[model samples]
Target: MLDWSKATKYSGILQLYRNLIELRRNKQKNTRGLMGQNIRVFHTNDQTKVIAYHRWMEGGPGDDVIVVANFSTQSFDSYTIGFPNSGTWELRFNSDWKGYCEDFTNKGYSTTAHEGECDGLPCQGNVGLGPYSLIILSQ
Candidate 1:
């Protein structure tokens, strides 16, 4: 059998767990979705090994959340992604943050969204994506 107490002392898993719990608790807007709202896989780029999607209650703005993920080993400095609206979107969580794990490359991530169009959406933004990482952005 594994010694659970000894394992917790050596791992930062608890911190990550706490962060996730806090996020879940604070994101009231996402509650609708959490309670069987909706999920849409908005974009996918096989060449870049990237995928993006939105989760929301009625699929408008405020409650809307976007999630981007990179599956490739290569990082993208300014990878473009579609936005549901033309407005500011804040980076809520980044899986590559060094706080989660020391070996991760703490890439300078962008916290603001830019206006444009991609993937059939009215707005777009560029983001610094770390290899094999996931990021959540919200208004």
Candidate 2:
């Protein structure tokens, strides 16, 4: 068992913070303050993963950020995202691969809720995103 509060752990993301781009067999971890940057990423372990939470780099100037979530769930290529101020956002990427929208209703994301981004958009503090899907938000 490793300590997540002591030091940085690369067990959950593709890029360790923002420096390295690949994960060695035995060594891999990410750090804090790595909330910005655009780079290639590849991280996975069996069926479980560390990238549990989705983020938007907080509130600031819009910089291009690509997050590829390789989890188990349905995804949307088109939807709305509410910014900090109070406006709906547009989707730039979505799941092109199959096997993403399974059990979405069971997970509470029924088609009616996802009816053309008409559903309530997530606030900045609680942004909604897809699983195992690549998301690119640029400005």
Candidate 3:
């Protein structure tokens, strides 16, 4: 059996789950895009073991969300990926945050979409990715 006592402590795995679950279900924070059905896979790199996708409810600034996951052990300082439109994207969640695990490097940040073509999209942005980590971004 798992040790519930240890998990209930601050900055433990349970807290991480609570944070993630709260964000995914938060309506007041405009994170409901994660709960929407619209999704589009925009980027995928087999060699790097990375994939990126966009999720939206009605699509637009407040309802759009981008998710990137790194499945490899290698981390990237800046991985270029596509965005549906040009603007700012906020880094809402990073799985590598030290709050979840003391050893995590916490590599991930917000990015601004520039006028460039990437993964067949008109706008592109660069973001950090930690080893075996995932990140969520929103407009």
Candidate 4:
């Protein structure tokens, strides 16, 4: 049986995922990040061959932003990401949908994704990701 701690962790992750979804719906995002001119997109079409997926070029100003998608119908069992430490982080965009929450001045949540600055991490909190969902972050 799964450990009780893991179950709590999963629940916490789900909550964060939900917050991301809600935040995405309520904010606007920055386009292209620091490397919009040379943006790289990551996605998949085949689930079975994901183990041998093609690798793409990676190198940027460290302030550059990244976007990722699952592409497959099945959800990811687990995944990892690496980023340079700078400050608090927030998910501002997703591949599945457009974001507009940052434009709080408008008739929206009155919050901006690109304007957020956490403590170099996602609140050191749980994270959940849904199928075909995209994840965007800011420094």
Candidate 5:
């Protein structure tokens, strides 16, 4: 039997779900484009177990979003990933944030993207990534 009273105990999980719901609701228009050719797999490295991609609505600046995922069991420091343009890319979400789970390292990162070239993109940024984590960034 399930304990109904205990359901409210997982505030962290609840918050995470709320945030995800908000993200989906706020980006609803742009998200529809994600299903089509608007999605681009920008980089992938099997050795590092990392992949990066871009999603946008009509492929414009404000609607542009970058996602980086680390599927490895190890953490990475200064992990470089490419960006389509040179500008401020805000770190919108980090799955490894301790706020999401107590076991997380809470090894937060810079809120803005760095300038450089990587994975054939005109701009790049280095980020600290935790194991089995996903990060979302946007300009």
Candidate 6:
């Protein structure tokens, strides 16, 4: 067990959880999709231990959110993932960011969707992913 007395409020894991909670509950950020009922699981690769899904309200621009996770032990410099629309997607959160933890390998960035057919989606984007990490992107 962990010692609660030694747990500081400034700990990386604590901050990470706070950030995620704020992201999910803050309505002013236009992230209602995280609270919405619409969801689509678009990609799942057992070999690579990766899975991706989309969450949206009405879908488009500020109302859409895409989540991708890597469960493997290896990292990828460039992994193609599908997007619902063709445009710039902002990197809202990255689980592997060094600020979240000292041992994390900071990877993942905002990417623009390009013209292509991938994972049954109309647009595709290449993103860097760290091992056992997840990234959240939004428009």
C-alpha RMSD values across all candidates: 2.8, 13.3, 1.8, 15.4, 3.2, 2.1
The local lDDT score (0 to 100) that residue 53 gets in candidate 5 is 91
Cα lDDT of model 5 by residue, 1-139, tens digit: 8565755787776777676665555554433323335778989999999999988766655577787899999898778788877766666678888997888875447544456777877788777788998877766
Ranking by TM-score: 3, 6, 5, 1, 4, 2
TM-score of each: 0.80, 0.27, 0.91, 0.36, 0.81, 0.91
Model 2 lDDT per residue over 1-139, tens place: 8465744343323122221232111122221113533233323334433132223334333422323343555443433333222332233333322223332221112111122321133233122345544433322
Preferred candidate (lDDT higher): 4 or 6: 6
- Poorest lDDT segment (10 consecutive residues) of candidate 6: 23-32
Clashing pairs in 5: none
State candidate 3's TM-score: 0.91
The ten-residue window of minimal lDDT in model 4 covers 103-112
CA error at residue 14 for candidate 2, angstroms: 21
lDDT of 6: 0.86
**Greater-TM-score candidate between 3 and 4:** 3
Candidate with more favorable, higher TM-score: 4 or 6: 6
Residues 1-139 of candidate 4: C-alpha lDDT, one tens digit per residue: 6466665545644454675655434334332343334543332335422211111124322234544454444444334333333334455544333232221111111112232233342222212243545555544
Pairs with steric clashes in candidate 2: 9-29, 9-30, 10-28, 10-29, 10-30, 69-132, 70-132, 71-132, 74-100, 74-101
- Superposition error at 48 for model 3 (Å): 0.4
True lDDT of residue 11, candidate 6: 84
Cα lDDT of candidate 3 equals 0.88
Candidate 5 regions with alpha-carbon error over 4 angstroms: 1-6, 27-37, 111-116
